[model samples]
Each structure stands twice: as C-alpha cells, then as structure tokens.
Target: MVGLGTMGAGIAETLAHRGLAVVGVERDHESLRRARARLAHSLDRAQGHGRLDPPSREDLLARIGLGTDLAAVADCDLVIEAIDERMDAKAALFARLDALCPPGTVLVTNTSSLSVTELAAGTGRPARVLGMHWFNPAPVMGLVEVVRTVVTDPDALEAVVALAGAAGKTAVVAADRAGFIVNALLFGYLNNAVRMVESRFATREDVDAAMRLGCGHPMGPLALLDLIGLDAAQAILASMYEQTGDHRHAPAPLLGQLVAAGLLGRKAGRGFYPYTAPDSGEVVGTGTAVGTGTAVGTGTAAAVEVPPVRRVGVVGSGTMALGIAEVLARSGHEVIVRARRPDAADGVRARVRTSLDAAVAKGRLSEQDRDGALSRLRATTDLGDLGGCDLVLEAVVEDLAVKRELFTDLDKVARPGAVLATTTSSLPVIDCAMATSRPEDVVGMHWFNPAPAMRLVEIVPTVLTGETAIAGALGLARAAGRHPVRCADRAGFIVNALLFPYLNDAVRMVEANYATIDDIDTAMTVGCGHPLGPFALADVVGLDVTLAITRSLYEQFREPAYVPAPLLEHLVRAGFLGRKTGRGFREHRRR
Candidate 1:
C-alpha cells in the first residue's frame, strides 16, 4: 500500500485481516504513524463486532509491516498502491516498484478515479499496473473497482479480481476513463443539484427533501456534497469534463469558492453546511445553523415578500390537483379547487380531506391542522370563480392544447396581475405562453409528485415572462413551502431532462446483464453512496413515465442511445407500476 490516509489504512486493515501479509510504504514518519494507528483502530472495531476474533486481530496487526521503502514490497507476488492522486508522485513510486518486483508480480493502484492507462505506463511494466480502487472505510464498504488499461495483462487483472474477493470486497472490471463509471454518473447529478441552489431555484433543504421523498434517495445532493469533500469532488468532475467535454460535469462556481475558503467538508471546519465542531458530528447550514433563527438567501429569495394570500385557485382535479389542493389547504391556502364538472370537483375535495385525515391518523398532522387546512378548502366547478383569487396554479392534465385553452380562459377572467402558472412538469413555457396573448404574464411552476410532501418546484420561464411574473410565482412556491428552481424553457427541463436518460442507461445495463439487478443496486447504493440503485429508482419513477421521457428525448435527439429500453416496455405491458402496483424489479409485496 502506498499512502496511509483513511482509505489506504482501511484497505490495508482489510487485506491484513484476510490473512494476507501487507507491506505498507508511506513517505514520512508522521504519515506512517497515522496509517498504522488507523489500521489498528479498524482491526479493533472488527474484533468488537465479533467479525474478527481477538487472536485474529493480533495476528492481523502483526502481519502488517509498515515502511518508507518501495523495495519492502519487492518480494510480494502482488502489490496495491493507495497513494496521493498526483501522477508524478505515483509514477515515480511505480517505476521503482517495477524495477524491484519480479515480472509476474501484479501491481495495482487503489485510485478511486484517475487514468489507468497513464498510471499503468508510468511503470516500465505497463502490463502489470492497473487500478484496484477501494471505497472509504474499505473493510466495510464492500466494493473494489478494478480498472483495466488496453495494455493491461489479463492475468494481472484476474489476480487483482481474485485478491479483491480474498479481501472481502466486491469487484467490478471497467474500462479506464475519467471519473470511471461511478463518479461520472454520480457527480453530474450532484452538480445539477448545486446549480439548482446557486440559481436560487430551491433551498438546499427543499432540494434534498424532494429527491429523498420523491425519488427515494437516502440523502439529498447537498448533504452528499458535504460528505464528499467539495474540492475532491470538483477535481473528479473537472477531470471528466476535460476528458469527455460533457457540460454536465462542468464544475459549479460555488464548488471552487467553498474549497478555496477551506470549507472542504467534515474534515475541514466547514463546508456547504458547517459542522458545529468537526468531531462532534453536529452539522449546521444556512437555514439550519446553530444559534441562528433567520435563513440566508441570494438577494432574490430574501427579498420575496409574500402577500396576505387568502384564497388560491387550482385549475385541475386529477390526483396532482387533489394533492396540490391538500398541500395548499394544509398550509393555510384557502383552496378554490376547480374541476370541469361538479362531481369531479367534489371527488377531488373528498380525496383531499381523506389525505389530510390520514395525515392526522398518522400523527403527521394534528386534528387542529387537518381542520385548519380543510377549513380553507372550497371546491368549484367554474374557472371564473378564480376571477378575484390572489394566485392560481393550473395543475390540469399535461396536454399543451388542454393547458393553452385553460390559460386563454384564465387570461380573460383572472384578477389583473394574478400569477398564472402551469404545473406542467414537461411542457415548454413558450408553448404555454403562445396560448395566452399576454405571454409575459405566464410562467411554468412544476411540483414533484405527492405535492404535499415533495418540496422542489421548477419555476420555468420563456423570454417573454416578466420579472414580476417570475418573482410572484417564485414567492408563491416559497410561500407554499417549496424549493423552487428557476430555469429557461427547455424539453424535460432540469431534473427529468438529466434524470431520465440515466434511468434509460440503467435499463440498458439490465438488458445487457452487465450486472444483476441486486448487484447493480448494491453497487450504486453501497459502492457509490446513492440512496438507492437506479433499478429501484426506476421502479419508483414508474416505467410508463420513464418510457415517455426516453421516447421524448429520442424524438428530440434522434440518437440510438436515447431509445427506450425493451425491458421497460415489457414491464409496463406486464402492469408492474412499481410500489403503487405492488410489483416492479422487486415485488412491493405488502406490509
């Protein structure tokens, strides 16, 4: 092992515990001491958990030999380096190891991300050096990605794979590339989430909540960024952007600022959110700081002053409409819900009441809250009833023609200067604008599913949309207690635009059997730190919805890559509508 920080030490401890003699070489005495201490602590924990017996821990400790000499690993049949990410430093060490070790000795770099080919060629024995990346707290993380260069010896690759198995880590073989498979896919999503916050689209809390609840993610993007040091994460992403030239991996400005400020992560004194005291594990952020009551904003969100909003109008009566109405009423918006017909409107109102009451039963909402929320709700069969309403959100069906007709009708009847917004998740703002003669008066306000719970609301706008319209809609979403991300009119917009293609890729991976469903899910959740695997997320996102978005992207891009996966079609045909249908990749076989 070459560097003895947290990752290296964990890897060494894991190897030693598996009865393998580990020769760990660090440059300086202080570094060597830290590595040795970390390894001892890891082994002690393994003993405490009954995973390793006391005698085994002692043996494991005795087996590990720490040194500053590269020749120390000369006699070993296989050597793994977990050094600092500098190419020059690693190249120098590998050259020395290649000269000292026998030709058959397999060499590996436990680099999470770096070019394997470049690193491999650093040693004179190009066929020997490949990558054997370990996850943090490696003994427990259960993953080791073995990256192969084109020139890498097959036997060397096989030996590393066998060694990973011996060390009790799951191994995946991958082509050498920037960010490789895991971080390439992961960081793009994280960067987008940051842009969402940077643009004042949503608060960090709402953004994280929307992802966790709506998509079943374990942690929100912002929290994940804090965990993965902002500096290191940006470096990984910047490498991808430089290699692939994909704009998605382009580093957000805040990443550089935070890193420069030394607010790197839990290791640093602070990060995107600060830790009260690093070792205390108590973290605080803008809205959630210790000893502070007020929230910070980007001038705009701070300036938004919500009017004494009494009655709110909703121009649809579907589940989305009902959900929005319930959430609104629950938060004290006197909901004037409109459906096309009297029975439909009444049905929506009843559903909203039942939802509220269920919350009461679940102790999510008290009886007083349920009553207060319901007291403000009123069902209407007329759009004209919204004539004097302070705000009107159109949660109608997502057809452009249907939404345009409603907007035209509302254009004539809505109270002058009342915010006319569409909760159309996928439609363009300009298309919705053409329907209303006053295009500047219209904007897009999207809410995630189960509106009462999900907090993200993308406030999309066309060029014609006025600042006042943007401000008013943004204010309403915030007042409704939603994190609203603002964006220009585009197909699929931000979340779906980026998220759907990834889902399609997962479908492709499954179709290829590159990994089993369980393996892929585990690789993502445990290996890459995702809340759930893409397969699980796909089930929750719904096969039908995923298919629609994939087809839409294909229609726009005309790329074979964006084509919908056949498995998705078959699943939808089979009526496996995820948790709702109680069947998907894994059966949601009741409580």
Candidate 2:
C-alpha cells in the first residue's frame, strides 16, 4: 500500500487483516508515524466492536510493515497506489513504480474518478495496470470497483478479483472512464443537491429529510457530501465533468465557494453546515433539524395556524388511496374513502382489513385497536359523503386533467375551510389548485408509495395557496406519523427531482456500454448504501413510470442531462414495463 493516508492506511489494514503481508509506504517519517497511529486506532475500534479479538488484532498488525521508503515494494508481487487524486502526481508515481518494480509485477491505482486508461498509459506495462477503487473505512465496506483498461491483461484482472474476494469484498468490473460506476452515478446527484441548496428551493434539513424518509436512503446527499470533504467532491466532479462534458457533472458553484473559504467539511468544522468540532459528526445549532412543516431557510412565509382535523376523506381507489385511508384510520382519525364504483370501495375495505389483520397477527396492532380503527373507517361510492370531512386528500392518478377535474368537484362538495390536498408526485400543485375557485385551500401532500410504511410527506404549497392550508396539510401529515417537508410546487418536488436524474444517468451508463447492469447495481448497493441500485429500483418502480417522471423533469428544467435515456424509452416502447411485465432492465420472476 502506497501513500499511507486515511484511505491508504485503511486499505493496508484490510489487506493485513486478510493475512496478506503489506508494506505500507508514506512520503516522510512524520507521515508514516501518523499512518501507524491511524491503523492502530482503527484496529482498536474493530476490537471494541467485537469484530476482532485481541489476539487476532495483534496478528493483523504483525502482518503490516510501515516505512517511508518506496523502493521496499520492488520485491512485492503486487503494488497498490492509494495516492492523492492529482493526475500528474499519480502518473509520476506510476512511472516511478514501473521503473523500480519487476516487469511482471502488477500495478494498481485506487482512483475513484480519474481515468484508469490514462493512468495505465503512463506505465511501461499498460496491461499490468488496473484500478481497485475501495470505499472509505475499507475493512468495513463490502465493495471494490475493479476498473479495467482496454489494454489491461486478463490475468492481472483475475488476480485482483481473487485478492478482493479473499479479503471478503465483492468486486465489480467497469470500463476505464471518469467516475467509473459509483462516482459517475453518485456525484451527479450530490452536485444537484448542492444546486438545490444554492437555489434555495429547499432548506438543508428538508432536502436531507426528503431523501432519508421518502427514499429510504441511509444518509442525505448534503450530509454525505460533508462526510466526503467538499474539496474532494469538487475534484471528483471536476474530473467527471471534464471527461464526460456533461453539464450535470459540473461542480456546483457553491461547492467551489465553500472550498475557497476553507470550509472543506467535517475536517474544517464546517461545510454545508457547522459541525460541533473538526472531524466530529455532531452538528451545531438547532436550525438543521428537520421541522414538522414550518418554513425555515425556505423563502416562503411561516405557516399559518394549523386547522383542527378530525374527519378525513381520501379519494381514489388505487393502492395509494387505500394505504392513505388505512394510515389515517390507524392514527385515530375518522376516515371516509370515496371510490368511483361500489366494487372499488369494497376492494378498498377488503385491502385495509387484510392489512390490519396482518398488523394484528404481527403484534403491531392490538385486536381492539384494529377493531376501533376499522370502525372509524367508512368506504363509499358517493362523493357527497365527503362534504363533512375536515380535510380531503386526493390520491388520484398523475394526470393533471384528472386531478384538476377532481379538485373542481372536491371544491364544491367539501365543507367550507376544508384543506384540499393532492398526492401527485410529479405534476405542478398549482395546476390542480387552479382548477377550483378555492385555490387558496389546495396544497400538495405527496406521500410515498405504501403510505402505511413510509413516513415522508412532501407538503408543497403554490403561489396562491393559503398559509392555513399549508398548516392543515402539515398537521395532518404529522398526526398520521409522517415527517412533513415543505417545498414549492414544482415538477418532481424534492425527492423525485433529485432521484430520477441519477437513475437516468445510470441508464446512460448501460446505454454507453461502460458497465453491465449487475456491476453498476453492485457498485451502488455495496459502495454507497443505497437501498436499491438505479436499474433494480427502476424495475421495481416500473420503466413507464420512471420514464414519465424523467420527462416531467426535463420539461420543467430543460436540462440536457434530464432527457430520458433512449434505452429506457425503447424498453418501455417494447412493453417491458418492469416487474409488472416480468421484464425491464432485467428479468423478474412473476409472483
């Protein structure tokens, strides 16, 4: 292991733990001392976590030899470089390694974004060069992206893959390209998030919460960017943008400004937000916490007083509508579900009962509670039944015309001062609001799929929307055990606005033949901690729905990168609509 920095020390420790003899090299004696301390601290942490016994940790430490001499690697069979991301510095090191090491010794670079092909061309043995991109805290992360240049020898690649497997890490191969697999898909989303903060479309807290609760992401983009130093993120984005020439990959200006100000991230005690101290995970100040629905950094005025909500009405007969109705009833609100037909109304009751029965069987709900919730829920085909409801939520189809017509009808039938909310994920809330004379009463209340399970509710208010309506929506969402995030009425809102573009970028990767579906999926799931990779998620979401959302985004923003990948469009045209059709990006077993 060369360059004994944080990543280098981690990699060295990982190799030594796998019983491989590692010669760790640093630039100077002082740097070497720091590297040793870092390695020791990491091993102690592992021991504390019960991941390593004292005897095993000592043995692992025994396998590593630390030094500042680069010549010591001459006799090693493999030399891995974990140096800084500068092209000139890495190329110089590779050239020097090629001269000092034996002709047959395999050389590898652990670059996350730089071109592996370019790095290989600087070596005397291009075929012997490849990239073993490991994630941070190498001993814990499960992935290693094995980047193969065109001239990379097959035997050398196989050796690296075998080595990765022996170390208990999964290896995914990708062609030589900027950002390779993970960073190619990841940094673009991160940059878009910074742009969101820069444009003040949403507050930092709301942006992060939208992804965490709405999409099931373990960490939000801004917090992850803070963890990954802003300077490092800027470098990766610059490299990717320079190589791909895609405007979306360009680093957001706010990133450069922060770096210029020396607010690099946790290392500097500040970046997107202030940390409790340098290198600390705890954030300073109470402003960053996710609010129930009040506007903070958002330019919108503070929410008006939340109206009291008791009786609730849910419109539509789809899965979303039934889920919302169930959630409302479970939260102790009287729920009235209005379906278009009696059969659909019956189906809603039947599904809710099944769900409640499952909850009772799982001990999540007591029989008495289930019975009471069921008693509070009423399903009917008559739209007039909703007249007495305090809040009427529309979980109808995504079409603006359908939503507009329904809103017009709802405006007439719902009681005066009733909060009218739409659950449209991509359409403009204002369009639906304008369909009724009571536009001030209409707000966007987007609930994720499987509403009973997901806790996110994006509360979007249009220009004409009343503060009272906003407060009512927030109150209802909070009462139903959901985290309410406020954003302007825009296409895709917060989560989809930031999510689908990354998915589209993944499609473009496969379209360009840069990586296979399995490799790309593995890169994201194992490296970035995404609940599902882009292709797998697209298949689950349905290709048709994914394409429509991307289209809406493109139509709204006109970003070239937001254009739907032709491959995705072709699949949808072929009727490969995803799991629903048993095929999309990959084959699925029908249930």
Candidate 3:
C-alpha cells in the first residue's frame, strides 16, 4: 500500500485484518507517524466496539509494516496506490514503482474518477495495471470497484477480484470511464444538489431532508458532501466534467466559491454547514438539524398565522388518498373521504380498516387508537359533503386536465377560506390553482407514496397563492407528523427534481454498455450507502411514472440531461410498467 493518508491507512487496516501482510508507505517520517497513529486509533475503536479482540488487534498491527520508501514495495506481490488525486503526481509514482517492482507484480490505483486506461499506458506492463477503487472507511464499506482497462490482463483482474472477496468485500467490474460506476452516478446527483442550493430553489437543509425523509437515503447530499472534503469533491467533479463534457458533471459555481474561500467541509469545520471543530461530526449553529424549522426558500411560502384545521377532506379512493385519510384521522382530525362512486368510497373505508388492523397486529398502534381513528373517518360520493371541510386535499390521477376540472368543481362546492391542495408530484400547481376562482386558496401539498409511512410533504405555493393557504398547508402537514418543505411551484419540486435525473443517468450507463445492471446496482447500494440501487428503485417506482416525471422535468428546464433514456421509454412502451406488471429493468414474480 502506498500514500498512507486516511484512505490508505483504512485500506491497509482492512487488508491486514484479512491476514495479509501489508507494507504501508508514506511520503515522510512525520506523515508516516500520523498514518500509524490513525491506524492504531481505528483498531482501538474496533476493539472497543467488540469488533476485534485485543489479541487479534495486536496481530493485525503486526501484519502491517510502515515505511517511507518506494523500494520497500519491490518484493511485494501486489502494490496499491492511494495517493492524492493528481494525474501528474500519480503517474510519476506509477512510473517509479514500475521501474522498481518486478515485471509480474500487479499495480492498482484507487482513483475515484480519473482514467485508468491512460494511467496504464504509461506503465511498462499495461496488462498488469488496474483500478481498485474502494469507498472511504474501507474496513466498514462492502464494495470495491474493479476498473479494467482494455489492455488489463484477465489473470490480474481475477486475482484482484479474489483478493477483494477474501477481504470480505464485494467487487464490481466497470470499463475505463471517467467516473466509473459509482461516482459517475453519484457525483452528478451531488452536483445537482449543489446547483439547487446555489439557485436558491431550496435551502441546504431542505435538500438534504427531502432525500432522507422522502427517498429513504441514508444521508442527505449536502451533509455527505461535507463529510467528503469539499476540495476533494471539487477535484472529482472537475475530472468528470473534463472527461464527459456533460455540463451536469461540471461543479456548481457555489462549490468553486466555497473551495476558494477555504471552507473545505468537515476538515475545515465548515462547508455547507458549520461543525464544532475541524474534522468533527458535531454540527453547530441553528436550523442545521432536520425537522427543527420550515426550510423556506427565497420567494417561497413563509410560515404565517392561520386558522386551525379541525376537519379535513381527502379526494379520491386510490392508495394515496386512503393513506392520507388514515394519517389525518389518526391525528385527531375528522376525515371525510370523497370518492367518485359509492363502492369506491366503501373500498376506501375497508382498506383503511385493514391497514389499521395490521398496524395493531404489529404493535404499532393500540386497539383503542385504531377504533377511535376509524370512528372519526367518514366516506361519501358527493362533492357537496366537503363544503364544511377546513382543508381539502386532491390525490387524483396525474393528468393535468383531470386535476384542473376537479379544482373547478371544488371551487363551487368548498366553503370560502378553506385550503385547496393538490397532491400532484410533477404537474404545475399553478394550473390547478388557476382552474379555481379562489386561486389564493390553492396550494401544492405533495405526499410521497404510502403517505402514512413517509414523512415528507413538499409545500408548493404559486405566485398568486395566499399566505393563509401556505400556513394552513404547512400547519396541517405538521399536525399529521410530517416534515414540510416550502418551494416555488415548479416541476418535480424537491425530491423528484433531484431523484429522477440520477435514475436516468443509470439507464444511460447500461445503454452505453459501460456496465451491467446488477453491477451498477451493487456499486451504489454497497458503495454509497443508498437504501436501493437506482435501477431497483426505478423498478419499484414504475418505469412509466419515472418517464413521466423525467419528461416533466425536461419540459420545465429544457435540460438535455433530463431527457429520458431510450431504454426506459422502450420498456414503458412495451407495457413493462414495473413491479406492478412484474417486469422492468429486471423481472419479478408476484406474490
């Protein structure tokens, strides 16, 4: 192992833990001292956590030999480089190692985004060179991206894969590309988040919260960027943009400005958010924690005083409508669900009962609570029944025309001062508002699917929307135990705006024959700590719905990157909607 920095020390520890003898190298004596201390500290924590016994920790330490000379790696069968992400510096080290090491020794570079093929061309044995990119905190992370150049020998690649498996890490192979598999899909999403913050479309806290609460991501993009040093992020983005020439890969201007100011993430105690000290996880200051306050963007809705909601009306009999009604009823609000037909309304009541019963069975709710919530819910087929509702939420189809027509009817039937909200995910809320005479009363309250479980609710207020309406929607969302984020009436709002584009990029990766579906999914789920890979998530979200959302985003922004992938469109056209149809990027069997 070479360049014993944070990543290097982690990798060295991982290999030594697997019972491999590792010769860890650094630049100088002082640097070598720090590397040894870092390794010891990590092992100490592992031992404290019961992950390693004292004897095993001592044995692992003995397996690692620390030095500051390149000549020491000459006798090693394999040499891995984890140096700084500079092409010139890495190339120089590779050339020097090639001269000193034996002809048959395999060389690996742990680069996140640089070109592996070019690095191989400079070596005396191009076929012996490959990229073995590992995630940070290598001992804990489960992935290692094995990048294979065109000239990389098959035997060398196999040896690396076997080694990774023996070290308890899953290996995914990718062609020599700019970002390879993970960073190619990950950094683009991260850059888009930075652009969202730079444009003031959403606050940094809101962006992170949307992904965490709405999409089930382990960490929000901005916080993850802070954890990854800002300077390092900038370098990766710059490398990706230079290679791909895609403007989306270009680092956002705000990122460049932050780097220029030396606010390089947690290492500097600041980046997107302030930390307690350098290299600390304890964030400082107000409004940095999630769910503390409303994340209102510039020109977006603000929190204001509004009348308390006592009675709520949910329109439609679909899954979303039933889920929303359940949440409202459980929150002590009288819920009236209006369906198009009497049978549909009855179906809504029956489904809610079943869901509540399951919750009771799982000990998530008490029998008394379930009975009380059900008693508070009513179902009807008349629009006139919603006249006395304090707030009416429509969870109808995605068709804009259908929503506009419903708003027209709701305008005549709903009582004055009642908040009218649309649950559209991608359509314009302004269009629905304009269909009603009381445009000031209409606002967008987007709820994620399975509304009773997901806590995110994007509060979108149109230009003509009233402050009373915004406040009412925000208050109601909080009352239902949901996190509300305020943004302007725009296509895709917060979560979908950032999410679908990343899914589209994954589709493009498969379309270009750069990587296989399973490999890409494994890379993301294991490498980035995502709950699901992009393809698996797209399948669960439905390909047709994914296509529609991406189309709406492209129509609104006219961004070429937002254009839906041909493969996705093709699957939708072939009637492979997703898990619903038992087919998508991968096949599924119905239970």
Candidate 4:
C-alpha cells in the first residue's frame, strides 16, 4: 500500500485482517506515525465491536509493517496506490513504484474515477497494472472493482480477483474508462441533484428526502455527495465530462462554487448542509444554507393557511388507489374510495384489507391499528358519496380524457371548495385543471407506488392553481406522514424529470453492448450503493412505463437525450412489460 490516507489505511487494515503480509508505505515519519495510529484506532473499534478479540487484533496488526520509504515495498508481490485522485500525482507515484518493485509485481490503483489504463501506461509494467478499486471503509464494504486495461495481463487481473475474494470482498470486473462503472453512473446523478437545486425545482432537503424515502436509497444524493467530499465529487464529475463530452455530466456551477469556497463537505463541516463539527454526521439546521426558506432562485414557497381535511375520497380501483386510500385511513382520516362499479369497489376494499393485513404481518402495523384503519375506510360506486368529502384525489388511469372526464364529474359532484388532486405521473396537470370549472382546486399529487411505504408526495400546481389548493395538498401529504416537494406542473415534475434520462442512458449503454446486464447491475449496486441498478429498476417500473415517461419528456423538450432507447421500445413491443408480465430486461416469475 502507498500513501496511507483513508483509502490506504483502510485497505491495509483489510489486507492484514485477511492474514496477508502487508507493507504500508508513506512519504515521511510524521505521516507514517499517523497512518499507524489510524490503523490501531480502527482495529481497536473492531475489537470493541466483538468482530476481533484482543489477541487476534494484535496478531493482525503484527502482519502489517508501516514505513516512510517506498523501498519497503520492494519484496511485495502487489503494491496498491491509494492516494489523492490526481492523474499526475498518481502517475508519478506509479512510475517510482514500477522502478522499486520486483519484476511482474501487480501494480494496482484504488482510483474511483481516473482511467486505470492511463495510469498503467505511465509505468514499465503496463500488463501487470490493474485497478483494485475498493469502496470506502474497506473493512466493511464488501465490493472491489477489478478494472482491466486493454494491455493488462489476464493473469494479473485474475490474481487481483482471487486476492479480493481472499480479503472477503465481492469483485466485479470492468474495462478501464473514465468513472469506470460506478462513478460514471453515480456522479452524474449527484450532479443532477445539484442542478435540481440550482433550478429551484425543489429544495435540497426535499430532493434528498425524495430519494431516501421515495426511492429507498440509504442516503439522499446530496448527503452522499457530502460524505464523499465535494472536492472529490467535483474531480470525478469533471473527469467524466471530459471523457464523455456529455453536457449532463458537467459539474453543476453551484457544486464548483461550493468546492472553490472551501465548503468541501463533512471534512470542512459544510457543503450542501452545515455541520456542527468537521467530519461530523450531524447536520446543523432545518434547511440548507444555500437557499432561504425552502427555495433558491424564483423565491420560496408562499405561506398559505390551509383548511383542515376530515373526509378524503380516492377515485380508482388500481393498486395506487388502494394504497392511497390505505395511507389516508392510516393517517386517521375517513377515506371513501369510488370505483366505476360495485364489484370494482369491492375489489378495491379487498386489496386495501390485504395490504393492511400484510402490514400487520410485517410488524409495520398493530392488529388494532389495522382494524381501526379498515374501519375508517369505505368503498362505494357512487360519485355522490364524495359530495361530503373535503378532498378528492383522482388516482385513475393515465389517459387525459379519462382524467378530464373524472375531474369534470368531480367538480360537479364534490362539495364546494373541496381540493381536487390527480395522481398523474406524466400527463400535464394543467390540462386536467382546465377541464374542471374550479381550476384553482385541481392540483397534481403524485404518490410513488406502495404509497404506504414511500414517503414522497410531489405537490404539483398548475399556472392557475390557487394558494389554498397548494397548501391543502402539502398539508394532506404531511398529515399522511409524507415528505412533500412543491414543483411546477411540467413533464416528469421533480424526480422523474431528472431520473428517467439517466435510466434511458443506461439503456443506451446496454444497447451499445458496453457491458452485460449482470455486470452493469453489480457495478451500480456495489460501487455506488444504489438500492437497485437502472435495469432492475426499469424492470420493476415496467419498461412500458419507462418508455411512456421518456416519450413524454422527449415530446415536451424535444431533446435527443430524452428519446427512448431502441432496446427499451423493442422489449415493450414484445409484451415484456416487466414484473407484471414476468419478463422485461431480465426474467422474473409472475407473482
């Protein structure tokens, strides 16, 4: 190991724990002492956690030799450079290591974004050079990306894979390229989050909450970027944009400015969110410092007094409708679900009951609470039943005509001043509002699938939407234990607008045969810490849905990038509508 920074120290500890004879080299005596202390601290923590006993921990520490000289790595079979992400600095170190190490020694770099092939070419042992990119906190994260350059020896690549497994890591191989596999997909998404904030589509907190709650991501994109360090993120994104020439990959101006001002995330005690101390996880305030209140550019969300909602009406007999109704009832509101027929209304009731029962089985709800929620829920085929509803949410099919017709009927049958919300993910909210006599009452309340679990509810208001309607939607979302983000009524709104294009690009990557499905999936999940890869997500979302979203985006903006991937279109045409049909990008068993 070379340069005993965070990555280097962690890698050394991991290797030593695996019983490898490891030599950790640093530049000077002071740095060497710090590296050894860091290693000791980490091992002490492991011992405290019962992962390592005292004797075993001491024995493991004995396997690692820390020194201030590169000559100490002379007899090692493999030397890994885990230093700063600068090409010139890394290249210089590799050139020196090449001269010092023995012949055929596998030289590995733990670079997250830089080109492994370029680093390899800087030395005399090009064929022996490869990337053994490990995730942060190497002893914990189980992933090791084995990057093979075109000139890399197959034997050298295999050796690293074997070594990674011996160190208790799952290794995935990838061709050497900018951002390689993980950072390529990851940093772009992070950059988009910054852009979303820059455009004021939503507040930074709301953006992070959406991914954390709505998408099941462990951390919001901004928080993840903060943990990764803003300077490091900017470097990775810059390298990616330079290599791919994609404008979307370009670092957001706000990100660059933040790094320039020395607000380099947790290391500096601030970046997207302020911290109480350097490297602390605790955030300082309610909202990000970059924007006032809940916005940046076009002013903040206006304060409006919202009327209380008692009875909520949900229209539709589909999964979303049942989920919404369940969520409302669970939130202590009387929920009336309206379907087209008596049988359909009965089915909706059964679905909601089954969902509530499952929640009880999973310990997410108590039996009493389940029964109470079911008691508050009623299903009826009559629109007249909604006349007393304080709020009526239309969770119908995605046809403009169907929604417009329903809104027209709702405007007539619903009580005066009742807020009308449509749960449309793609179609224009303005069109639905235009169909109703009270356009001011119609707003878009897009709830993610399985509304009871997902926490995000995008409150989209059209041009003519009144402040009371906006307040009502936000208030209801909060009352139902949801994180609400207000966005203008536009194609894709907040999340989908930024999300679908990336998924489309992933499809394009597959179409170009850049990598296999399993490889791509593994790369994103293991490397970037995504809950699911784009392909798996596309499959879960249904390819037809992805295509429709992409088409809406393309139609609205006419951007070539938003155009649906040909592969995606072809699969949808084959009736491979994802998990619904038991097949899509990959095979699945029907539920």
**Which number leads on lDDT?**
3
lDDT of 2 by residue, 1-591 (tens): 898888999999988888999998999999988998998899889899999999998899899988988999999999999988889999999999999999999999999888888989987899999999999888889999999998989999999999899888999999988888999889989998888777767777889999999877899998999999999999999999999898888899888988998988889898887899999988898554221223422343344565568999999989999999999999999999999988888888778999999999998999999999999999899989999999999988888899999999998899889989999999998899899989888999999988889999999988888878887888888899999998888788899999999999999999888899999998899898888988999999999999999999999999998999999999999999999999999999988
lDDT order, best first, reads 3, 2, 4, 1
TM-score of each: 0.76, 0.95, 0.96, 0.92
Tens digit per residue, CA lDDT, model 1, 1-591: 777788888888888878888888898898888877887777777778889888777788798889988778889988888788877877777888888999888888877666778877777788988888787778788887778888988888899989989998887776677665567567877987777666555456656665665566677777778787888888988887887787767898877777787777677757667788763346664554222122222234335464655678998888888888887787777889888988897787578888888888888999988888878888888778999887788988767798888888998899887878888877776877888777877888888887888887877777787766778777777778877765656667666765776777666666765445775676777686677788888787777777887787777657565689899888889998687788877789654
lDDT of each: 0.76, 0.89, 0.91, 0.86
What is the C-alpha lDDT profile of model 4 across 275-379, one tens digit per residue?
Answer: 999999999877555631344312323477767788999999888998899999999999999999889987876888888899899999999998999899999
| Residue 374's lDDT in candidate 2 | 93
Better of 1 and 3 by TM-score: 3
What residue pairs clash in candidate 3, if any at all?
Answer: none
Give one digit per residue, the lDDT tens place, for model 3 in 8-39: 99999999999999998999999999998899
Candidate 1 residue-wise lDDT at 73: 86
Candidate 4 or 1, higher TM-score: 4
Off by over 4 Å in 4: 291-293, 296-303, 357-376, 557-559
